[model samples]
Target: MPELKTPDSLETQSCQVILSVLYQLNLNHENNVAMSSERRQFILDCLQPSLRQRLISMITYSLNQDLNVTCKLLDYLFDSGIPHLDLITRRFSSFYFPADQVPTVYRLLSRGDPTSLEKLCIGIHLDHSEEGDWEDEEKETICWYSGVKRKEESVSKVLVYNSYFYPTLEKMKKLRHVVLHGVCDNQALSIIGQSCNLLQYLDITGSSDVTDVGIQNLVFPPAIQKAGRVNLVNTRARTNPSMKHICTVLARDTGVDVTGCIILLQFCPRQWI
Candidate 1:
């Protein structure tokens, strides 16, 4: 019988072969279940940081096309602690809060480690069905993380909406752009007007609670008036009377510009009139 010998680099070669086969199988019209599982475990076990990062990038690119792959890649990243979280944040534009990973993501944010997050976008909706209703504790956790006090030095922009209006505005004095999609009472508007003076762009859209009285009360400080661009679209102040008030205020103001106004008076419900 002829002697059988395995090459010294057989293990490394096997790993590469498995990875190549898995890559091809993933691209095929139909994936091989057993082979895919074996390759996935093998790739994960290899524990190469570069490989992990590449996988995350590939998975994120395919997120809209293949959620399953995105989820799997997220699982791998979370498990492996890919070290460079910047890729994860960049890849996941809309925060991906899988039920199992929500706590981990929350912890990462709440830890007050600035480097943990590169970008943050928070969306709050009155309709709970759109996303899970944040518990008071979770809300507070999110508020704490989203607050400007905790942001990493690398963070440049923070886009927030919904229940986020008050807490986020109150703390994020460095914010450059803000969009208030839901209702904002007089108090909320005042808080923003007073705190976020550095804001450059602001959009108050679909806010039924913001009436002409509330709009008139929004006295931007000199700094904000000089630098900010304000947009009031589809709000209670969309009526001719309310718009006149807004125009009068803008005209009187020095620092702000309300040049592009999309005031739809016909859409203003009778209740507002």
Candidate 2:
């Protein structure tokens, strides 16, 4: 790993101060989540251009929502246009967005350089709207992604299985870490195994769509290749166990191990944690 440049003490202090003030302001409140465009501008106007990305990063983190939900407000915020929009989108290499954002993610990949992307994590937005529920803590709030409190019943949950989205991901040759929780499909998983040469970690837990066919694509590509960059494939996979043994047999000789979480396949067992 290369040395990372840490921000100066002053910038760190500034971030601390800004975060404190933001908490007090309650912009994260349910009522304010989908704030008016003017309100979004007000917050941006208060920050220096250099610090804007940090502010956005915090909001994105707090929301912990997929890029699709976060970007909805962002697109509105940048409606009037602002500086550093490109800076935020282009420089952000790590993405942990829901599968619904695949189209949006594709746009981000297509418009920007795919080589810049490093970590891509895609998972399903857990929908708890089951038969019945009563616990306050267990109840889902906001629109799944937003941290705001739920005002009413949420709209339908979406599961993305588009073919085009996978193609865009293939272009991300530099991608490394990936986590597909509850949303890993066979085709997409197959693409990741064959295309992502530099891939290090993949965590697919509780996903039912994956099977040995996908693992086959990952462990044995159609053609010969150079030394692989794979390090570990972690599977806390809980949904499908049928493919567990198949994966084990396929990768046992190749220094990869299989466990159960859907189907966990490690590229280098020695390095697996």
Candidate 3:
């Protein structure tokens, strides 16, 4: 990492003071305390344009590997009106956001460059509150690429959970792996099946809206590229006749793993021989 250049005179002093507070808070984050939004903004307002960018870069790159710090920094960036979209998408692996805050994320992306969106690994943070329970105590949030590389050639994996609106998949043509929790519906599954040509690994949990038709589209399609694994658990997709046949064909013909689709486990023995 290159050394950070300090601003001249009072600006340098102000930056040092803010950075000291930020670092102290980061180190003691176990106390679950955070800098107030107003305080962060005040410090930002005091810095020069170049200094602002450097400060943002310092927070992001300095704690990219520390989930707690990264989450806190990301939240600050989101609230700061300068998401630095290009920097985050290119350098960070995952992001978590409350369901209501999702639109802010999209808006930030819209205002910035979209060139790096295709190559970076992206994941959605499922708000645990969607289930009608939210704890008063602060909980640790995690981004999907917590353990993966920061920079990669293409976005190979995505995790979505309890999302209200389906994502537009037109830009994810190179997607290879996906994990959907309570977010896969007939329309969304159909869109993914048709557009994501390189898709292979998929895990869908708690998708009550998916049915035989949606499940089938995942295999036989204009964009069919026989998936390596299809782990379907706790879904309401029917486990009868036609769906069984498709699973059988995918397993026996294309070698796709459908054994994890618990509903079809019985049929696997009969047809997969």
Superposed model 1: Cα runs more than 4 Å off: 1-168, 220-273
The CA-based lDDT of model 3 is what? 0.41
Q: What's the lDDT for all of these models?
A: 0.37, 0.45, 0.41
Per-residue alpha-carbon lDDT of candidate 2 for residues 169-188, written as tens digits (9 for 90 to 100): 66665556665554555566
What TM-score would every model get versus the actual structure? Answer: 0.29, 0.45, 0.34
Give residue 28's lDDT in candidate 2 (0 to 100): 55
Worst 10 residues of 2 by lDDT: 248-257
lDDT of 2 at 82: 25
Model 3 backbone overlap count? 0
- Model 1 residue pairs with clashes: 225-255, 225-256, 226-255
Runs of candidate 3 with Cα error greater than 4 angstroms are 1-96, 108-167, 206-208, 222-273
